[model samples]
Target: MSSEQRVLHTPDPAERENLATFLSRALRLDQAAVVRLRKRGSSLVSAWVATGFETLAVRTITAELGVDDVTVGADTVLAGLRTGHPVDLGYSMDSAWRGALPPMDGFAHVDDVPARALVELAERGADLAREHGGVHGPPASLLDQSVLTVTGADDLEVQVPMRVVFALTAMDFIPHAGEKAEARRIQPTELVRVRATRTWLRLDARYGSVARRLGGGIPLSPS
Candidate 1:
């Protein structure tokens, strides 16, 4: 992987002001604008302002560029777009991201695991749940939630609702609430045992989009 990346396009304060003005004027005509970045070769990038989805007015804003660090900015921008949140283009474009591997707190050494491997395990758990054919349930109550304790390399006891297990396992970091306010990296290990009182899974409302896209409704509650 390239150590550095470049940002092809980002809005500046003046550009934002211009956009706001344009939007105010264009709203009278029922039109909108979108900004896009087009990459050209390894060292060239261009920016374009399209009016109502037009595709021929993009211009190269920056000169031929060398490698630059832009991953965090790009990811933050994408996330903002995905969540329909406002983005501080200035900060995102100028700020530097922290190192890739930050310290992992709250988790035991066994929780140190590769993100890819963890995702794979979650996928496998989901597959198992599908094969078993069970009804989905709501999230477990905090006081009665299942717990998985790990010490070393041992057979994992998979007793929790497969959906919950899959969601938890798929997370890159698990955040904790309290005075400390820290997150822990999930370490991958085989030595673990799960104790779950519930046997059924729950389709979280958040997965509604996935269900809709898959042409299926959330599973009905078990009778």
Candidate 2:
């Protein structure tokens, strides 16, 4: 399959409920009340529905785990550019989404392929949402992301390079009514943080083995 043709599944009821509960707890809102609020006209499943909110979550999670800044691959960069969207990769769900970026200037840059792919995704998502007038059907959607990063080494003093994936979704938990025309489409974007100790150098030897073992890197050859 083409890299741009990534599959993003819908969220199940259980997933929605978990997200709702998590939001309620994080925002200190009553679970039942939160659910009700979510069901209200023009609403979001979680208070963290804003586009930037996801980016914030990514940065925070990465830092907390003591991982360096995240980097985007050529595919990601190209995807975003093509689709007018930004996102984390598929493997992120299992790998904790923290070590996605490869270190560079204390931050990570988007890979060419994914950046362009996002542009197409953005267009598709926006078009789809526009068609429904901002009402997503029963099942919610997801967008996964994989990133590259540089890790700190204990003895060699050479930062170990790595790639990680963080998955994201573009979902409409509750169908909102009277939402502004702009609110119908969720724009794709990215947030990069600086705090690593390496520069641009695809040390595939160093990271390739680790990525393969960790199940994060894309298969060099299609299966």
Candidate with best lDDT: 1
Q: For residues 95-117, write the lDDT of model 2, one tens digit per residue.
A: 22232333212323222222223
lDDT of 1 by residue, 71-161 (tens): 2233333433333333433332322211121111222222222333434555554455456534642222321233333333354323222
Question: After best superposition, candidate 2 residue 163: deviation in angstroms?
Answer: 21
Output the lDDT of residue 137, model 2. 29
Q: For every candidate structure, what is the RMSD over all alpha carbons to the true structure, in angstroms?
A: 19.8, 19.3
After TM-score superposition, what is the CA distance of residue 101 in candidate 2 from its true location, in Å?
Answer: 18
Clashes of each: 10, 56
